[model samples]
Target chain A: MSSVAIDLAAVNKSYRGKVVVNGVTFTVAAGECFGLLGPNGAGKSTIVRMILGMVPPDAGKITVLGKQVPAHARLARAGVGVVPQFDNLENEFTVRENLLVFGRYFSMSAREIEAVIPSLLEFARLGSKADARVAELSGGMKRRLVLARALINDPQLLVMDEPTTGLDPHARHLIWERLRSLLARGKTILLTTHFMEEAERLCDRLCVLEEGRKIAEGEPHTLINEQIGCDVMEIYGGNPHESIELIRPYAQRIEQSGETIFCYAPDLDQVRKQLRGRAGLRLLERPANLEDVFLRLTGREIEI
Target chain B: MMRMTYGAAMPANARNWLAVWRRNYLAWRKVALASLLGNLADPMTNLLGLGFGLGLIVGRVNGTSYIDFLVGGMVATSAMTSASFETIYATFARMHTQRTWEAMLCTQLTLGDILLGEVAWAASKALLAGTGITIVAAGLGYAAWPSMLYALPAIALTGFVFASLAMVIVSLAPSYDYFVFYQTLVLTPMVFLCGAVFPITQLPAAFQLVAALLPLEHSIELIRPAMLGRPVGSVGTHIGALCIYAVVPFLLSVALLLRRLMR
Candidate 1:
């Protein structure tokens, strides 16, 4: 078995005249959780598709596990699991049948699949709904079913595309907990997510992409520390820009969005001193996080 | 010298397609009774209405009673309709609406496997529909038993041919409504001109030429004689034509779908 689960070298892809992924390269070590984080149309889907061998990258090389992709993709996929971006459960089947049919696609016998169904249902918290039709399940239940279905083959590397895009806080936290358990069992995970918190909580190391190019790559806290510093000061309401000059000397980076001004620094002593008795301006100081890092790197504008 | 190479994984595995076929078979089994009855209802109506009602007026036009003459055509029509409808409607839902094929693609199965399994399932349904009508005709004393058993191969071949052709239509169809054109332009015409209810010889010379080209016409050519306990002529030619219809369209559907969806 190869220690490297996935490796990409100078991969390039384009559709018609427009470039989608431009010379992006990354490697995922065995049992390491790697994330591909980018805004919409940042070529995240194209890259993922290339890795899965669904589409041939126009240029560059890709290897998943030990097989060169789009050539030995079937052999490679025989050991990989994928949770797609949306809930596409087999609607006609019951929860157990859904898992059975998916396992069949992997060439598993019914007896073999039946052997694993109970444990997987327990893992998904869908043990009670074993015979329930897919439509009878809630959105969270359906999402969990898709997750459980992906594990039918007991894959070595799990690729998840936005695993928790729409879910209640409780369901989201449960899925996160399950993912943590998967990691604890030494399963490698490659995730693409729009949620900064999801990427922060799950990914051991991640790459941030912007307009088909990699802009930043590192650990969540390390990137936050290197770019935005230890503390972030927010000034809400009032003329927050007027205080920018006051706090500029102490702040390493300052940005203004709408009626709020953000100040990042090692500490808020200078901001606290300068903004003292600033009247209507409400100032809040907290530890900087991954969202702060993401916004600073990708910009606030919604990429269409 | 320039290097020329392309890499596209088209792993052709029989086991993979069998899995797809098994999935569809399992699902279809839930509604199998209703579906078979629905297919029967159409042909049964035509047989009783045209065979008995019209046969009373026509008497024996072709050396046999019109009711007995119509049994073979009805069997062929049932096979074609069942296979075509299953491919157009059920396969369409799996590919476009439910995104079932998309889900299967994420697994170890390839596009080829998915399509082959889908068409094979449709063909199986066709086989059942055709065989059902034959058994019904035999029970009603309209067809001979030992001779009717010979029609099974012909009926099975018609299933493959129609299922393959319908899948080609499905691969090219944009939405549900696009199927109306295939129904109107291709299938409905075949019914009237392919000797299902009437002999193609009664038509103008040009239409006879057209009817002779249809796969359903060849189907009836093989099945009618067998059901009537008569000699089947040009057996190799009819079988060859049906084989072309089955193999060509199936391969075409596979290629067309690869171009359409895999991109």
Candidate 2:
């Protein structure tokens, strides 16, 4: 048996003469929580689709649970669960019926599906809404139900694509706690999100993609330290060029955006001291995190 | 270049297709009464209104009561309507609006599994509508009871023909509005020219030739004889044509949907 849950080697995909996922490579180990963090259209969803065998890569090899993709995709899918970015729940069925019907797609018997409905509902905190129609549930409730539906087969690997994209913080935290429990149960997870904090909280290791290429890969803190240093100071409400020139010597690197300047340094004391007496300059200092690392590596340019 | 293989595009397991069928069945079971009533209303209305209202004027063509002639044609039309509505509107809703096909694709179910299952479900719904109308016709003394039973398989075949052809339209459909072209251009024309409302002999010679090539015309030819207990004419040709409609479009639908969804 292979220790790798998913393996992609030199994978490439293009659509209509335009490259989407270009020569990407990564491996998700068994029982490890791996995340793909990138902005929209960074090919995160495309990569997820390829792994699910929904689309074939133009070049390279992909294996999930030791089975070659698009060849053994059905077999691989039988062992994998997916929570999509969109709400694709069966609108005609009740919450419980949704779970039951989806379970049938995996060839599970009625009794087998019924046996897990209670526990899965509890896992999603949807026990009270079990008989409610999907349309009757709130967005949070629907998302929870989708999560429960993904686990109907008790899959060995769970794939989530922007799982909490539209949820409120409370709902997001609820899902995050459930995901943590799944990781504790030793389930391998492959997650994709633009939410860096979500990745930092749940992923054992993560890779950042920009324009179909992986720009950085490591543990959250390690990538932050390597790419962004220990602290980030933002100075707004001052001449951007003047701020950059003053903070340049003390900082490891400086970036100037419209109306503000960001300075990355080992420590913020010197930069703060240099800018203290300057009037009309508003300064804020924070510990460096994944978002800083993401912005620095992928750049501040807005992807159209 | 690696040629795209149908082996990867189409599902190999029969059980997976059946599972898709079962999923639709379970969902439909909740609104079973409303669904049946909705499917039955149009055909029943046409049979009563046109059979009596229009029958008063064109009374007893071809040695049978006008109502009797209309009953068999209505059975064929009922199957066509039910199957077309299911595959075109209902299947399109699932594919685009509800995103049900995408959800099923995430499971072990292939796009081919969903397609075949949808075709089967549409056919089954058509069988239901056709069977109900046949029973009503028999109750009114227009059709032979036992002979009408033989029309069940023929109704199923009619359902398959329309359902498969409608799915080909669905594969190309971008939205619900796109279905209007098919409904008006294809379905409406077939309803009028396929001997469902009037005898094909009434049409011009050129139109008669065209009508003979339609699936519904073949359906009516087989069904009319079976319902009236008359010996079927050109049994080989009628059934053979209907089978071609069912099968050829089914393959085309699979190929079209593969291009649409698998890309």
Candidate 3:
């Protein structure tokens, strides 16, 4: 109990009777980087809002940092930092002013805010752009400023919803590196992301959510090994109707796309042998990943 | 030295409320400037065009110059219009297009903080614009020096009342065009009929009853007597009415903002 940072028990939330979240129960261990992986409309934002005390759950208790949410949300929030999905930087102020103004809310003295400003700028590599207007900064720079602003109060728990949602690869990697440093310093983090690779890269343990319910929960490699087979072979086109007919004999599990076929089997060599005899067919084998786990557990296609 | 990561750091959430205010202030500052400038333009035109142009013909009211009648009206007009603009237009944008209030709610800030900060700032802007018009009025010798002191605070409170009222409108408003309906159907007619431009005695009986229900009628009536240095009575009644105007909408706006934000 002492090591638990966030505890959600029997939590349910409904929007105009839609029941967006139903009986979600989980505990985020202190110093653990936990990830919630799901598609859009999977109630990730709903749960995040509930934990932040933005909305009261219909029936349940949410405790953050050992205090009940919203009721004690002010105190709980004092120790928690959040980076939202869309960057909400104030366009009227300079990048530094945005940070300074936010830091003021935590009741930090001017000296203390100033003392941390330099280090924070250096941490996010935004030292030179402090005086730049928020409107003038590039998308990546604004993102970094927001991250730095979130760290101003030096929170014990950090919650970020899709932090790298629309960023390019380089910008995303920069955020990843900064987050890893935060983890090394023992800051507990609750993260939600649609990126499989980000979950695989950053999270210590993750829950896969589909339609507002947790379908699978485990470490990345463990989930891939247990739920998904070691290898997958994607077969494309000999004929539209007869495509599954050809691979069905060898494949233990066969799933069809519009014109392509996916054959999941324990023995890749046997599947390859059958595919070799047939001409005008394409075959590629790769290791299984979170996308495959999502497919196996949620029974949904990997649109990406 | 053993470096502490966050050694009993000042809790960020305490400041969360202020951050929400800062966000709104920064978002609306540009619009506030434009609105203030636009409002100042009206009085400046009065100072240049009406006070001078029509001053030669109409002369003065109660031995005071024509510029005098225009000055008090312009000061009251600026305060009313600026406060109304802040609430109606900018509040709508924050609620709808900017999605600013929604973004702020995701933080530790409560809806009450946002409302207080916004109302305070909007009132401040209206007072400042009122001051500018007053300065011009003083220079023209229409506004008395002592009256400026009392009238400034009065207009500030008046602006706050309207700003809060606009917030309520934004909360209930469904579309941008709804503002036009509000300004045209509700605000424009109210301002004209409220004795801002003419005396309430000149208005018909039905129009006078309608104007009495609106806050601006009381606001202009309260300031007009003071600007004219007339002995006004029942000061308590005016203050009470204005207080109800400001407080009711303010509370409603906070509640509505909280509801929308929580969603």
Candidate 4:
């Protein structure tokens, strides 16, 4: 009954001499919803694989559910559930049969699995399609079924890797609501995603990773406020150096890239007054969010 | 912070492997009738075509009807074909196309559990195919009913050997087309050269030596004697060779698949 559900100490991994996860250390407490946010190739999936014992780390230690990883991964995994990034549902089986067969994988008897199938189908909003073949179900339905399948064993620790990556807004919201209910029931969740909004909505505490290194770790609001300030002002079509000099006196920080310059400040009015009526200059002001903090820390350059 | 300990570390066990087997069974049950018919058709056609067509001219080669001699070979080939198809095509579909193996890995099932379960399922399919042909052979009056009962374990062992060998091939295969190489280079050649259709004595001295080393030849050797109620020659050596075929490839398959799937 360790307070921490997952602990990674100085974990490192590489593929053919290219380091993917470098010197990463983090702990997820029991019943906490922790998020790992990063761009593609930032090693989010690699970390998830290491936790699942699918891959061994080249260096350092990992422990899940109080058991040392790899050595005790099976024991730990028995109490854990995972929803992988890809749709791995059995296309050959019907919706209910998919759950039924997956339940057996967790060692649940037919009687137990049958008993829960109805309720789990209802939970996934797929009660109407219980007998529908997986190929017949829509993409949203498939994702929901995958989510329901992960709960077959009522796992204590739920690991979801980019659970809402390819879904529509409607589907994403439904999944988020279901996840919230799971959290209320006191299940620890370790999630990874590229969507900053999803992390902000679901994660209790999150870490931002860039190129296999941790850039920032804290509560969402704290990271936003501490790193990027209260508000962000985007100024377009202004001379970069002049705008920087003009905004520098009033701004806490200024980030200039291409045609746009971002001004982070305690108050937007002071910076706004200086740029007011300036020829060909347009200003858009909004409250800072996790995306701002993410961009500021990880940079605006697209990671190839 | 309170710390808890797991009661025991569960290694790869029979229960987990059985679960994998059950999953495949449940899925296959949807098309069970069609699948059985598909499995039975090939062997029956061979029995009828070769038994009647070739038997007319050749008559008897070993003091028995050509149909009776070919029955034992048909049983061995059916087992090998069924097991090979299951492990290569069906298992590959689960691993690469359907991602069923990846799904199983997320649960309590280990890679070892998945591989063992796959082999067991393939062997079961082989048993079904071989047993069906054996029954048909009995109906055609080519096999003694009492002696045919003893062929069950031999057929099962044949299935396991071919299934394990197919698994080893699958672990290295890059695409579906890669299977053609195995089918051509290994399976087809063995089907003809392993005394499945004709006696090994009719071959050249070198080929006869080659046939003696093959698993299918060992399987047919054991099966032919048992089905005919004749005293099995060199029983120990044939059984020993079959055991080696079943076991060595199985271990190799496990090692290779573990490396491929477990990274």
Candidate 5:
């Protein structure tokens, strides 16, 4: 078995007598990208804060990078880097100044910091804007700088909370590409995002959080396979009752949306064969995705 | 490019404090030199306006020129103003708008480290500003070299005390508007009535007792006597009062901030 970088046992957290994280437990193995998938107010950030020892868990224990949390928290955090959801860069500093200043926290000498900064900037694809003030950067540029700042200490574990939040598609793809590079270089990453596509594309393993509890855990494809069927046929612009009756026999699961009906079947070809005789039905067949797994798990559409 | 604790064995608190100072130094060096230079404009205005303007009216008090009399008080006032604003207003913006402290806490830094770092940095800025004011005061023949040496520690003490008090304000403050209440109601009253612009003896007895309890009053009292060539009355008592003023609020603010952050 691979060594665990983050280990939690029956962790519980509460705010003002209301329990948020209720007896949650999980482990993230070394060199793996573990994604926490949740909707808003799902207590994802709270759990991440506890793991980083920013807040102490009310009950149970957590360990990161082989050190017990909230006790040896400093030691644990020494090897950890974080990219918060908000862009929290110092506006007065240039991009290079921001990186140089953060390097000082880890006691990196000036020459050493100078040497690593170019590579770090290149890693974030922000090499050209190094001398520009952080205030002058775009939202995407700021996000990339935050990521580059997180890398200054050469952390063993990187925790990113909604790292691609509020970014354009191009920026999101760029961040994902950089993250993939980091993973390939054997960096352990813990990420939280509301973007199912992001989780599908990046996570080696993932867990869905609902109201502070782990509702589902597995690989993205495996999750869809177990919770939702392999194939789903979305039938819109047809009579709902007639469509359900017609497609129900061919599907493992049938769901409806206003005027449309969705049928999930193991074999799309067989389902299509059964629907061949039905007229006035516009049918579209596609493979199940993380959205399907998410809806199956929560019975609600995923949003920020 | 990373080193562990700078090759010295240190306690956990010490190590974390160093990290906090490291982060603060990084942050301060990014902005403060310019900030200090900007703040020098305030005392220069005071020297130019208050010293020359008011000097024409009052002429002298306690055998010293009005320009000389006002320079000591202005230095203390600037120190208080800089330290208080640095932590209260600017710190509030960082806490709420920027969320910098929230991110910093996610690292190895503790609440104590943050508190110390901010206070120390503000104190350092106050010292630099105070030094500039002193130089300007000396050039105007308002201060001598002895008072300059005394002013260094005085400015630092004044800044430390106000920075701690402002941190307490930061702990309870939720918005930028709240800082206005602090400045208008609390800081304004103290600056006006706390013997900075004038001696506390000129105030009524009830106001005198109130001023005695204030940190700003104590700061002005501690620094003013030395500048005026007075005996400075029991150095131990002055040190004790200033330390208490700085320490009590510092400990309280740290406790409150730690609870807010860690909980």
Candidate 6:
């Protein structure tokens, strides 16, 4: 119980009688990074909001850092940090003023916030832009500033929803590095991302949700292994239906989407060899990744 | 060491509404010059154009010059527009466009605390608008010095009344477009009907009954006498009416916001 940072057991939520989250359960051990991966309207935001104590679940219980949620939400939120999906920076204030103002939300006085501003700016690599208006900063700088602002209280757990969604590769890598440092210092992170590469890289364990139900939960590697086997042959730019028909016999599982057919097989080399001389086809064989597991579980078809 | 993490746990916040107010204050500071001028523009035009243009046709009203009679009404309505505009435009931006309030909710603050902060901030802005006109009135010698200061509490309470009322509309508003109905159908009509321009007695009997029910009428009643250095009347009833406007809509707004946002 002491080691568990967040526990949502049989949690259920509904909106206007529409079941948004139905009997979902997960636990994040302290000092571990947990990822919640789902497509749009799969109830990811609903679950995140409930955990932050914004909405009460229709059924089940949620405890965060040992405090009951939506009841002790304030006490729980006081110890938690959040990096929202959007940067949501205050454009009206200077970069430094943004951090200064946020401290007061935690009941910290201006003077206390002043003492922390310099160090927080340094953490964000934004010391030079301290007095600059938020509108003046680049997208990357604003994101970093938001990341630094979330740490004003030095929370025990950090809840980040799509923290690096719109950043360029250089910026996203920088954010990833900052997150790695936070994790190294023993902060438990609850992450939700559509980036399978990010989940593969950063998440120690993750859960995939389909239509508000927990479809699969395990370590990324284990999920890839169990759901998608060892390798996948991605055949694209030909005819996916015909490519799928040709590879269906040897592939463990085949999912065709758009112009690409993902053939997940225990031995995809056989499929690769068989397609060696096929005309008008593009094929690449690689180790099955988290994207393969995610696609296999949630399916490649568009969901509303 | 410059290690700036303040991880020390503390008691839950009780007065962090001030924090929310301070944020609005900081945000407003950037556009302070333009906004103050905007608030001044409405009453200034009415004071010059209507006070002179319309005042000539209608001579002394309530035993005073036409423009002087309008002074008290202008002060009351300045607060009305200030509180209403602030609540509808600025507060709505924070809630919808900027998502500032949404970010605030992610912190230790509750919906009630944020609402209080918005109310207090709107009231403060209304107070500024009301005071600007009061100073101009005193400068023009239409209002008594220091006595006009007595109207300030009434000004603030008017702010509370209208700002909270606007918040109720804000809680119900689906988008920026919905605010126009309240602005035109509700607020713009209140100006003409609430005795902000002419006396309610000048209004028909049916209109007077409505003017009696609205908070602005009671406000102008209290504030006009105070601004003119006249002996005020109906003190208890007026204050009670204003208090009802301030408290009920405030409570209703918080409840409605909890329903709209928390869901």
Whole-model lDDT values for every prediction: 0.86, 0.89, 0.76, 0.87, 0.80, 0.86
Candidate 2, A20-133: lDDT as tens digits: 888899999999999998889999999999899888888989999999987788889999999999999987689999999999899899999999999999999999989998
Q: Between prediction 1 and prediction 5, which has the larger TM-score?
A: 1
Per-candidate RMSD vs. true structure?
Answer: 2.3, 1.7, 5.5, 3.4, 4.4, 5.0
TM-score of each: 0.95, 0.96, 0.90, 0.94, 0.90, 0.93
Error of 6 at A190 (Å): 0.4
Residue-level lDDT for B62 in candidate 5:
65
**Could you say which candidate leads in DockQ?**
2
Output the lDDT of residue A183, model 5: 95
**lDDT score for residue A110 of model 4:** 93
- Indicate which candidate wins on lDDT: 2
Candidate 5 local lDDT, A1-304, one digit each (tens):
3389999898988888888898889899999999999998888998898888777788888989888887777778778889998887888778998887677666567888999999999998899998999989998889989998999889989999999989999989999999999999999999999999999999999989989899999898889888885788888775678767766776888766557676888777877776676778788888888877877777766766
Q: Which one is best on TM-score?
A: 2
In model 5, which regions exceed 4 Å deviation? A257-260, A273-282, B1-38, B43-59
Q: Each predicted complex: what DockQ?
A: 0.52, 0.68, 0.25, 0.47, 0.36, 0.37
**Which of the two, 4 or 6, has more lDDT?**
4
Rank by lDDT, descending?
2, 4, 1, 6, 5, 3
Quote model 4's iRMS: 6.9
Residue lDDT tens for model 1, B151-263: 99899889889989999999899999999999999998999999999888889999999899999999999999998999999999999999999999987887778767755
How would the candidate models be sorted by DockQ, starting from the highest?
2, 1, 4, 6, 5, 3
> Whose DockQ is higher: candidate 2's or candidate 3's?
2
Error of 1 at B138 (Å): 1.5
Question: What does the lDDT read for residue A21 in candidate 2?
Answer: 86
State the displacement of the C-alpha of residue A253, model 6, in Å, after optimal TM-score superposition.
4.0
